[model samples]
Target: ASPQSGYTLAVLNVGAPAAGMNAAVRSTVRIGLIHGHRMLAVHDGFEGLAYGKVRPPGIKGGETPQEVEGTPRCRGHPPRGIFHPPRTLPKKYFEEISTNISNFGIHGLIIIGGFEAFTGSLELMEGRAKYEELCIPLCVIPATVSNNVPGSDFSIGADTALNTITTTCDRIKQSAAGTKRRVFIIETMGGFCGYLATMAGLAAGADAAYIYEEHFNIHDLQ
Candidate 1:
């Protein structure tokens, strides 16, 4: 497909920093490019979207760079920006975001982040009724250590985190066994979801695991 025959799409990262964010963006950009779409990488998340801080990836200062080259293939620190509660931002900001989208001629958006990405996409979907510019295609890719995003069994960076925790737990258990310790408590990161802790505990062979989904009292712990 010719460049002129392709859609103008944007990809951005939102919410807290997470592993595998750059890889997601690279895949999005590469796939879009292969399909001959014009891909713009927006920095700083939604704030960048509102302010129009975007440029074609791999373009230094070209008048019109055609393709994004040398996209990062490793884990990247995701930008933590542009995350607000649904319908909490001032109306004027939404207007600006819509206006910027139109100005940039972005026909679609690919948001890569955690639960906040899901909420952000829904917020934009809700705005479609009021702002036609926001009616464009939206895609959210889950990439958080929390693994809290619904509709998916696992998120991008979750497995990596789970492995790290499991391995660390093994080492701690070995040290404790050598010292003749009876009990040890390990913690993992998952804001409201218990996926990480539960999975790590099982993998590390812990006697018990506590999570947000299951309420536990002092008696339960005992």
Candidate 2:
């Protein structure tokens, strides 16, 4: 179901930030708000949740100057910035979060990360029964550079990685042309799947592209 179906969705990003982290957070928040549910952020991933680093925004009372209409007591006052202490998760952070899910009135969660991130997600999902008793749902969105997620065309970072590689390759091609270089060998990360390398090569107009998805013969390029 879409986020705007009146479900309180919490987004827990378990890995390092990338180009689209903020976008994902913003989108999730916007949709959740539209759906008529309060949104909470779990910072620093499972570590944050485990350590009780969840933060929710709310108004705190601040001193304001008043203006007097007919008397001094009626005078207007300027507003001042309010301070709110960060709420650290409880000592039994995970257990507390699970039990208090109903108390806090949360509806769902969106987890974003790579394969390793699934470990925490799986933990949460496996514990869904306990959470569901309190009315909480969990969802996951894969967003790693590995592009190893099954049955998906691309992860969140795939496009950015491809663009970076293509730009770098363009610069290298210019230098190669200037220096009269005959060959250029570019190695990229991705142990079992070379989606990034292949896409970048094709987009950057490489002489040939090598990917783990297909067999390569050295003599074919020679």
How many clashing pairs per prediction, in order?
0, 11
Q: Which regions of candidate 2 fall more than 4 Å away from where they truly are?
A: 1-7, 57-105, 128-135, 180-182, 212-222
Q: Candidate 1 residues 177-215, lDDT tens each?
A: 877636677778898989998999899998999999999
Q: Which candidate number maximizes TM-score? A: 1
Q: Could you give me the TM-score of model 2 versus the true structure?
A: 0.67
- Model 1 residue pairs with clashes: none
Estimate every model's Cα lDDT from 0 to 1: 0.75, 0.58
How many Å off is the CA of 88 in candidate 2?
Answer: 18
